[model samples]
Target: MNRILLQLAGLFSALSLSAFGGGKVVLPSMHQAAVGEYHWMTSQQFVDLFSISMAAPGPSMMVVTLVGLKACMPYGTVAAILGALVATFAMFVPSSVLVYFAGNWWDHWKESPWRHAVMDAIMPISTGLILAATWIISKTSIHTVPTAILGVIALLLMLFTKINPVLMMAAAGAISWVFLS
Candidate 1:
């Protein structure tokens, strides 16, 4: 009981620190660990939770809370709730402090010669991580032809147009309901 909770705490806390761009950027590794290594949830369940987090009002990192609850489900709802809270706190707190201080330091160092070099060096890595996350999500969610088409269209729209993402998402939902369902 205590062991499981502690493990959940440790996993999310470590993941939080690695979230360079945002929570979404960490999804690929998080997915690998939660689904492949830990056996906390299925690939489908993970995608579903990710969708829920995306649709929710807050940051997509809320997926950690759902993951924690799902992982602790066998123990009991109380255990699950505790897992959710612990994971959420672990995911949010420490990295936030780092960001706060780092942001200040970055502004102070804005004129440093190595500042641009360091940021430039890390740009590719950050972009690669985000692309990896996209691949993982697309691989999991594109089980159907319509879905694949929809994703392509959404990507094209995102790339080419000035459309609001919310509207595009709603359009995709409507199209899916009309055609896929």
Candidate 2:
């Protein structure tokens, strides 16, 4: 009820603030919170939700909406939608507002040498965060040899080819449905 919605709001809000690199960067912690600390979902469910989110997405962080919905499943669908909306707002609005203001301030300082220096310094950290997120997703996702093969194929396709990502997604799904499963 009220308690669950509040918890969702708090958890997403905290994650929103911490999403320095991107929504993906927060997956590990969000997974721990939803699957571990709150006991709201099993690890398998968390992994499944993430897979679902990536497959059907406006944004990668749509996983938050899935998490929220799953959290309130015992309630009716309306409650579940409310839970999703609340978590989505918590995850997006606060960080967006901060970025908006920060963008304004940053523009004013855009010409400063120190600004470029700061960006250069932070690039490595951002890259590292993204790499860590990749590892986290890989560990959660590559549950079997076939899935790992699919992951490697997808990675190679992305890195070296001009193949459409949607096509890759479909190929992976087809492979999984036909073989991996």
Show model 1 residue runs off by greater than 4 Å. Answer: 103-107
Model 2: weakest 10-residue lDDT segment is 132-141
Q: Can you write out model 2's per-residue Cα lDDT over 1-181, one digit (the tens) per residue? A: 8898999999999989978768887887888888889888998899888878877848878999999998888798999899889989999999999988898788779878998788787778778877876787678778788888889889999999999777788778998899755
Q: In model 2, which regions exceed 4 Å deviation?
A: none
User: Measured by C-alpha RMSD in angstroms, how accurate is candidate 1?
Assistant: 1.8
Candidate 1 achieves a global lDDT of 0.86
| True lDDT of residue 85, candidate 1 | 89
TM-score between candidate 1 and the true structure: 0.90
Task: Give all TM-scores, in the order shown.
Answer: 0.90, 0.90
| Whole-model Cα lDDT of every candidate shown, in order | 0.86, 0.86
